[model samples]
Target: MESTSPMRLSFEIRQMSPQQKLPSPDVGGMSRSARVMALLGLQYTRPFHRDALFLFFFALGPAVWLSMTVLFALQPSPRHALWSPVFLSVALWQPLCEELLFRGLIQGHLLESMPKQKTWLGLSISNLLTSCLFSLAHLANHSVSWSLLVFLPSLCFGFMRDRFGSVYPSILLHVFYNGGYFLLIGSATR
Candidate 1:
């Protein structure tokens, strides 16, 4: 004998268990656009803190260069005050932009789909690619020497980003590296 009532059928169906809970996706595994937005948000929220490292890098860079210049005054080269403006604008500005693009945005997105080991490998590959692009971006400078210098340092920046888990250190390191290079060049030229 079977019950044919509509209410009885509804009751039977209700007896089934609810579905199991699935694991939540990691928040860090956001899309590139989302990560960019997040980075921008971070910058906006803590503009001072974010910019502090850069400012420190900027100030310290010149000082370090001056010291090295004084110490290595024996090296003869073309002295040019014009390079000061170029160093601040090009070297500092470019590295900051590149860090935001590569480490903050692109790396954040790629890390989403990757396992731990794969994430490291992906980061390495992405860093290399990004660094190459960065180096190539200097094509207008039109010097193989400049390109070669940029390539290795850009890789070092990527490596720093990977190790520190934040682009801030790398940004600082980059500014230092560039600043040091300019200071050395400027001192040598003098």
Candidate 2:
């Protein structure tokens, strides 16, 4: 009276919608290591396009530097030292690594379970949570105030990651922000 063949079961699974086929990785269905690998392997490249959001972030870099100058008495340091290893690390290395870890892995993993709805000023809950962790990570090498300031930019990076479905844009923005921030604010690392 009932069909229990493997073919029938496979057909039934095929009939289900994508959303119904399996649980999200963060929904306790996947092992921790498997989830980490899946998230890390998520799309890291998207066709480059200067969309409005990208333009907004690009312009915000200068504005941020100016605000730091006026608000925190941050002096613009000499650009002659721009070729130093520390400058290279902040501008290039750190952005790539941070974006890969935070946006590519952590936020991507969170998005699997969290609703995509914009909860805070167009940011998803995943972005907010990732930003908090990002800021906390900065506290190891930065002052409390400096670390807190990292939260906003972390949100921006996460937003770009979600919007583009890739980590490339986030990395670019991170580099732009860090290079300018260190150049203007003198890398106030503790």
Give the TM-scores of the predictions, in the order they appear.
0.51, 0.71
Clashing pairs in 1: 77-189
Lowest-lDDT window of 10 residues in candidate 1?
A: 15-24
Show pairs that collide, candidate 2: none
Query: What is candidate 1's CA lDDT for residue 141?
Result: 59
Candidate 2: residue 115 lDDT (0-100): 46
Q: What overall lDDT goes with each candidate model? A: 0.51, 0.70
Once superposed on the true structure, which residue ranges of model 2 sit more than 4 Å away at CA?
Answer: 1-38, 41-48, 70-73, 115-118, 187-190
25-95: candidate 1 lDDT, tens digit per residue: 23487998655555422233222233443345445555544554444453432456435666665458866
Q: What global local distance difference test value does model 1 have?
A: 0.51
> Which candidate achieves the best lDDT against the true structure?
2
At residue 128, what lDDT does model 1 achieve?
A: 63
Q: What is the Cα-based TM-score of model 2? A: 0.71
